[model samples]
Target chain A: MEPQNAREKRDAAVEARVHLIVFRLGEEEYGVRIDQVKEVTITPEITRMPKTPSFIKGVSNIRGDIIAIMDLEERFNITSAARDSRHTYTLVMEAKDYTMGFIVKEVPQSLSLPLSSLDKAPSFVQDFNISENFIEGIGKYENRLIIVLDIFKILTSDEIMELKS
Target chain B: MKSREQEYKEIFVAEALEYYDALSRHISELEKTPEDEQILAEIFRLLHNLKANAKAIGYLVIADVSHKLETAFGMIRNKELSFSDEVVTVLFDGIDMLGELISNVDGAKEIEPSPALLRNLDIIINTQTDNNTELNKVQKYYTSKNLSLSDLIYIQIKKLDHLLNLVGELIIDRDRIVSISKELDNDDLKNVSAHLYRITEELQYSVMDARLVNVGSLFNKFPRIVRDIAVAEKKEINLEISGQDIQIDRNILQIITDSLLHLMRNAISHGIEKADVRKKNKKTPQGNIELSAQNDRDTVILRLKDDGKGIDQQEVRKAIVQKGFLNADAVSDLRDTEVLSFLFEPGFSLAKEVTEVSGRGVGLDVVKNAIDSIGGRIKVDSKKGVGTTFTLYLPTSIAVKGALLCQVEENFYAIPLMHTDSVLSLPTEKLHEVGNLLVTDIKGETITVVHMRELFNNDLDTYNGTKTALEGDVQNIIIVTYNNRKLGLIVDKLLRQQDIVIKSLSRPVNTIDIYAGVTLLGSGKVCLVLDVAAITRYFIARR
Candidate 1:
């Protein structure tokens, strides 16, 4: 009975897979879940927001909500483009109680990868300044490696506090 | 499946509290007039409702308790048992037990009725069975045909708050439309804009009206609190309330509930004197305490007055000195009003010993803090050996305000009209240089001039100096009073006055206290509503 129960547990583990929404930050491609993507649109004019980290570009007036726009390149250690550049789109993402925008170089696309295709992020890839907790196991799609982003773990509570304070 | 049960239990608990409050109210009425058939029937109906609700929720223990109480009430309804205080008190205890049983459904596990409580309820039943007339006395309540149409509907507060938020957004859009129509200068667009403005204004008023709640609902609870304290303290006191019809925002009422509780407790614990002391002082042994509310303009004034021993400034002074809060020399120059304000200072309890009721001096400051949080002020007045009255002044609503628009450089800021005294163009030549600061004379009073540019202190550097009002020789000054002192805010222009919906600055923006909140101006630009009191205090402290 014990051996059979262990075999079922292994089967469940093998079946675990994460569906993600992949987007580009400069030359790098990253993936967050499609579930958390509320909208994808051209980055509009943003208000000059203060009391936040430099990674926070500004606030976007979407409908009536004043959502913060986080610059993904600056957040993930890629050199930032000029904020007013046209080569950018915003992904309105949600995780638990928080909802904010992520500015990426390309429009996000949805995809799913099985657990068998995923592997631990290479030590060099994890060397970015961003918190490694948000870097889920990496996978390859169409011969291009995609880094999975854990939406809930991307920004630490302390970082959110800085944006609010 | 397990989590579903947890959600149901939460619903049952919330509903049970409302039912319990209704039961307690109806039962209290029945106690006073036990022979009133209507009151008895109402109490029975309330119990029956509780029983059926508990049974449906699978809280069988609570249902059993309610059933037992319902049966006893049925016997009384048949005119079999004589109305007595002993019976009323016993049933009140039973109701209390039922309350405990309802609270015990914490969603963690199934619970059973206490065997001891069941036996106690059984004993009451057996004692009353001797006079039982018939077993078929299920009292029929007032029929549906006899029901009066109640105009009141209770919605969850969150719904109204959400509606208010959407209305706020609509108002912002309306202002943007008005600005656009004025720019286009088209008669057709202007006509539509005028109609839209009128309808939008009416909607704002109607929504605020829906949120208004009568102060009486809160004041009604005070009599019971006073009665319980009076009985416990062995004192004879009467609480006479007037202006129970005064209505204010329900949010403000809920915020001040704890403050009122503290004040009432203090009234009984310290404000009212003992019977012997009253007799020795050649006064009536029975004391009178009045709780009243009156509306003044857009503000509500709640005054709780007790004709007990008024506060003694000498005793309070000693406490302040003893607490080492002030030096003896410093305390000597304090006025009676200033000394009275000291009672609200923390660590200054007048009660010599800790009592369950109050008097540790910890609560008075809490009362002041609570009132302040609701954008209200509390003032205490007492004449030694006569009486003490604490008056609370609260706003009708905190969401919207009529404000005077003012410009500092190019930026627009709002000053609440309630605090604005008068706007004047003071000639800079007439302004006397008192040391390093500017001062002016208005109506034979010295007013400190505060430069908005300097007071706001370049917090929003990007928006700095876009519009300057100080280009002329004369400075535009708005006279305002805070903490009995007058200060003048120097601005470049004074725009038209209008009602603006204020939104609280959530974070980083709130760190700058110069602005009370953020509002969208008629031109669609975000404006900060100034906190006059804070600016006044900050200027004075700097001086």
Candidate 2:
């Protein structure tokens, strides 16, 4: 019976092990799943596409492959530097069959934490949210709120089809 | 693997498609009317704009191509280069290449322009520079003429659409005053209400008028299309456009451009006979195709009339029969006008052999579909060996107001009064079943009655007791006309008529096409606006 309880405890620990990649946009801390993140790099040249949604910055060529870059400031409806040099960074992610780059204010740091740390996002987030689809959950770390993002939901299938079309 | 960068790339791809379309038209026009300085200036402006934007976005391939086009235009403007048929042809080829590049941008496959094409472009650029002496003279001439050409500003249509939507909401808010006034009884309040009403009316009218733009902007490109087709067909044709100042909604104008282009091509390729044939027929040696636009009541009537050998009824009838759209017996009964209308039927083409211009079997049918998609009707009038005039009657605006309110399943729906012909009361005894369709007689006319519940797919019986109380003594029957046929719609009641702003349903609620849009009533509750024609078509198709 003692061996059986030990096995259950091991399984529980495995379930609790969840990793998040945290990033900053202005002053806010945001986190996405570690598996969803492909890479992080300094800002690169972005080729502008005419007549795109306002949030889309343009396309970028990264390591010989063409990828689209979306302005995180615009996507999050935040007011940041229109084009800042020192604060610029690119978050490379793979979601919804697209390899895209997210232009954020700074580099992201990977964090390994227990799933029990996450809690439901406050009602205020839903009321004033620009886009709630990509948000998975929220967690508190060091007196700051980390917005967990569902990268899969951010790059939706419909958006992929729209791009293809 | 999709990333944020890929999202931006897609945006670029969508924008590139629009720019390419403009570029192609500009190039095609330049080919035929190279001497038109204004057209050349426009071309230069468009290319320069594309290059600047492409560079800003980091689209190196587009930037490179546009840069070359801009340089070529710059040389032309300077008089260093003169227009040639070969040059224009090369420009057209370049435009086509641009279109391919844009299409590839969104595709999963890697995009690379043909090496041969790039080499050819480089050679053309080098050749232009070699002839800089002539280019300098051209530039001097342009300066002497006092023509100042600048790059065009590129704005997305969505931004304009969003602005219009906000204006529409403002108009709706202005109308809400009427509902508020109904609850007040004071004399001062009455005086203020009257003033508010007048101001709101003026605001609504002016805002709507602001959205109206001259269709000529779109029509201007067609002359070049006609000229190209005429040269290819070895025919002498003169194209005339009148009433260029007639205005319509910009949204409707864009949809009509493709249809009009197809029709214009058809006229040049198939409608107009060869120069010799035209001379033999006692018509002008140069066949004339006149496109005229005018307003008739609330409808905008656009006519494309060509002085050519009219549609041969027998040939059309034969094609109709071959296509199986009509039986032999039906063909025999059809009038010449009716037979001519068969050209608009899908997959029906009378051309003996397919031509590059139009014989793709989709031209006329596409015109019909385009017109129908915007709730417009196409009418054909033809005289044997004389001419054919295709008249299109379309509503000037898709954003309709002054709707007739009707109740169905305890909910009220607004049906645009323009589409609602007449309302009649159906006596219980007169309503009889005719081949599973309820029929009612109105002044010797037999009208088919479509139950509102079934049409909207509402879960309520035709004569539910609760509906009777709301309806009162009169059994409401709305008579609506679709494609010249009258259909009687049975409703629970006829509510008060008001000018309500139409709002589009969100994607989730728009699966059913019966509701053209949704609008908020005075009480702020959302009510669906029934698209009467779409509903009729749905019923007919289902049947």
Candidate 3:
């Protein structure tokens, strides 16, 4: 018992079911670990970067922080929902080494569920025209499947390095 | 051992190493002046914690050893014992014992210094300060051996980076506030914003200062290096070093370490003539290499000057002609400095005859490329039969770069000023077409000129659709060059030059190699900082 307690204290167990913040990316619901999010903010004036792929919505100031904005619709290859660009929402997330923001259609409520409830994504779901590795699992929440996104996997090493630059 | 104990041991080792570093640094300092009450105090304070840490970790042997060393350092601090060379030597011996014992505490190696060494140290400690003659001898010996100016608590490098990132954001906001305040024109707001601006500037400077480390960290290793090289090369080489106090950003120093080492080796092996040859040339038998650094304007100037066989420019010019980089007539009109730059041309010295002709070894070009990558400049100036000096101008900080802001269409961009040699505004008639590219003469040498719209591939529909210019239309040419390849970047309008704080673009945006990083402008606009080298490479490659 003593040794078990010592080991437990040394390596604190990582919680299996992380609190996830659900958001809409062009009508489809997606969930990212809540701890990975720094804050959710209204979209500021985004400065479009030239010579970058269309998925990169460019950069914007969040509070005092300059965060790179990623267009979720373009990244997921979903046609963007017709909405006012002026009233867009930005979900500021903590990437591996830096903080960035993703332009979301709307930030829904946060949800918590057991890890057992999440099923492995179907092979057809993997056929989505995006980075397949980004989707960790498909979890049922409120009569809808929130695709649990592996926030870390969304950006490759080179992309992370480039962003951190 | 339990994993918990193992964790403790890992931390112990890291902290112990830092304490050990402090011990060596302070000891070296005491050696220089053989005095300094604060350095002594610091040494004692450092060991107290180290002793405590070792005791806590059950490494009582280390604790006992350090306790004794701490007592010695404490005695020296209070002048209870005369700070003598014998005393410092004893302390250093104690330090070495402590290092070895601490390193093996994880059961890697069960090793400790002999007990007699500690007893011998005690004997040195007990030695009375009798005669001034002996004391002076010890002091004089240390005063000669000492060379260097040398961190604190081991905060995670991630934490330091996080702090820097926060400070970077504050700097951008500060620029915004100052600009907005001017536009506001409210008396109280103006006064308050002015105060905020000053505070922000001071904070930025303080954060940058914290990140800076003395270059002496790199320079301190040179004495040993030079000594080793001198022995190996069988040459009587005298390496004189000064300016062990100049500081630079830690990151810049890390990148330059290998390149600087390469340059020194090049100087030793290829630049310096042997003692016998030196005597025949009516020079001193011992070759002299002076490594010095000084702050020139805003740039840190490091000079590695050697008294040896200077670079043969005629050979370099001949190699250039042979490489077909230039024809014979074109090479003949070039200055010595201009011709000598070809020595840094990649594969220039790879050939057997070229090495025999130029009389230099391989990889000089690698040195130049490394320097260029870091936005630093390296210049070589040599006189025939005299000697050569390789001067490197490194920026004070890489975080903040001086950039020339320009507007292409609606968006603004910043071209790093380090890449801009100069700017030219000339009529269209002066520029001529060369095959598929446009070229202009800069001091009789052909320079490829690229226009903004065309370079961007007319991505944004230029209201003026053509790449061609009207008869009297002025061309805004920013001359950017690297490794003798020059390009004239023709932008639509020249904005003001500013000391821009570079913010790295995230992920996919950063994949665009032509843009170095992003800078938040005073008007709340994020402008991309152009990587001049990349732009030149892209345009040249496109051809």
Candidate 4:
């Protein structure tokens, strides 16, 4: 009975674990599934595009394709009282059809959390006025709360097009 | 692999559409000159070939229609029946039916010709219903030699587009390797690179050549379209088309076909005045529209000129103010060219009443966009009472472009050399501010100038390490011309011209109008290709 219970616990843990890449935007940490992140590289020189929103940092050359780069902090309107240092890393993300990059202030780390540890974002999220559906849930790791993001939702063509206009 | 039936159906549809086009053209010509033996023989031959091919493919409806049409033409050839209004009407109806049925051939549904059409044709030819006799006659005339397979084969254009894209990537990599070999200065590597470059050049040429189609294939169809539009509008338009053998990228022809048709419709309905009005204006009662294409160096120049009522600047200005798009003061300040450009603006119709052909106000803008999509430029020239001409300059190919690289501040931008007229150096002080526009005299021709530094400096505060290009005493001005309008753009430095492969920007970023597409340099840095035509149009509209 003891061996069977141990095996069941191991199976549950294996099935429930969620791998994510955590990056910092302002003071809060955000996590997206590792599957959604194509690659992480030290931020490259981004060419600024004219007549686009401020959040759209510009485009970067990735394997001969121009991938649009975005400033996640500005995109989500996260305010940090202290001025953050220069963006040190760019996270390449795979959306439905194309790949894009998001610039964050620090190099992101990969970590796993049990699926059970994720809680639906608090109702007060409505008061914060962040874009609706941008976050999948809030994740609780040992002592930190990570805002789990829905990358596909954030990269929805309709919302991006809206931001364009 | 396709089924044998499917393959035959494809052949049948292609041949049927060709036959329909030929018949329509000949029937229209026969209306004007009823005694042209050459046209008469051509029509009969096309119908005969179409009937045999369609019958073999089991497309019985098309075969039946072609057979009846062929019988009528045979009677005409035998001098038993002559050209009549009824004969022309029945032949046109038959051609239209063939086109309609051929388009729906993919569906495995049975098709039957309209009884009225068959009845009308029967009355013309007085044919007896003798299917076996007709089949024997067709078998005799259509020899086995006619059915022998040809060397030519049909290739799906999508496959060609995919191949072209792959070739574009290979060219980019080839360029990169060439640059790296040059930097290393290794003799063997340099030789190998040169050979590779030559081979890639030939391969690129062959791929591009495979996609070349005679412009006549597209131009031949326009006469029929023009005839239909003229008949609907009760207008007499003499469409003079030339340069039929000029070759262009097949995709470019496909992209511009509809836009050309739209222009033709606009010319007939709006640009051309009524017969009575033309007589009163002392112009020819029969309006003339010349559609011609010619090869211009590395580009194709297509001109559509109409001797119709040109755009009235005063009327456009009045409409601008009346529509409240701009206040009267602003409209008054606009130059005549600027006022004329409003005609291309969406929903900026000058027509007093919406006509079926045009003036629903959604045509010229779409036409402009189609031209832009193919990396082409279109310009309209009008002389009020004289006429209007829309001249389109299109790149011979889209995968590769000849671009002149220039630097502004710390970034690099490529200006398509086709649109670029000349590069000049001038003192910064030569730029004079004329009512909010910087105008400079270039050999006594006043040219509006804009500094690249300020034009692309919208996000200055958000980014760092960007400086204005006007720090020195002299400025590098590249004069770009679109239509007859020219603009002098000042840059910091000029770089060597290169053959760049342009990769279109994916979503969100593609909406930016200032940059056409981005190309990677030898140093792995991506440079934006400036949309010179759009920039010129913007400045022209500004003035």
Candidate 3 per-residue lDDT, tens place, B1-543, comes to 235456557768878877777788888988887678788788888899998988877888888888888877777776777776566666766786676666556676677566666675566555555323232221211122222222124456567667777877777888888899899898998898889888988877776776677788799899888777777778778898988778787777887888788778767767788998999999999889999889976688899999998887777888888888777997887766667767776676723433222335546777877777678878888886788898888887766778898887677889877778888897877787776567789897777787765656443223222336422467888898664567887788888889888877655455666777788898888787888777665554453
lDDT against the true structure, each candidate: 0.74, 0.70, 0.74, 0.80
Best by TM-score: 4
Residue B379, model 3, lDDT: 83
Q: What TM-score goes with each of the models?
A: 0.63, 0.53, 0.65, 0.74
lDDT of 1 at B276: 94
lDDT of 2 by residue, B136-224 (tens): 11111111222222223455667667766766665555555556666666778767877877876676566557567777877788788
Q: Residue B470 in candidate 2 has what lDDT?
A: 27
Clashes per prediction? Answer: 4, 30, 3, 0
- lDDT by residue (tens digit), candidate 1, B333-391: 66677678777766668887777777665658788767756567777899889989998
Error of 2 at B197 (Å): 4.1
lDDT of 4 by residue, B309-408 (tens): 9988888899888876788997887667667767766677767777777667675888878987887878888888788998888888878889899998
- The candidate that wins on DockQ is 4
TM-score of structure candidate 4 = 0.74
Q: What is the TM-score, restricted to chain A, for candidate 3?
A: 0.79
Off by over 4 Å in 4: A1-6, A26-28, A73-87, A105-107, A124-133, A142-145, A157-159, B1-47, B50-150, B273-285, B309-340, B443-446, B459-469, B533-543
Clashes of 1: 4
Candidate ranking under TM-score, highest first, comes to: 4, 3, 1, 2
Count clashing residue pairs in model 4: 0
TM-score of chain A of each: 0.77, 0.81, 0.79, 0.91
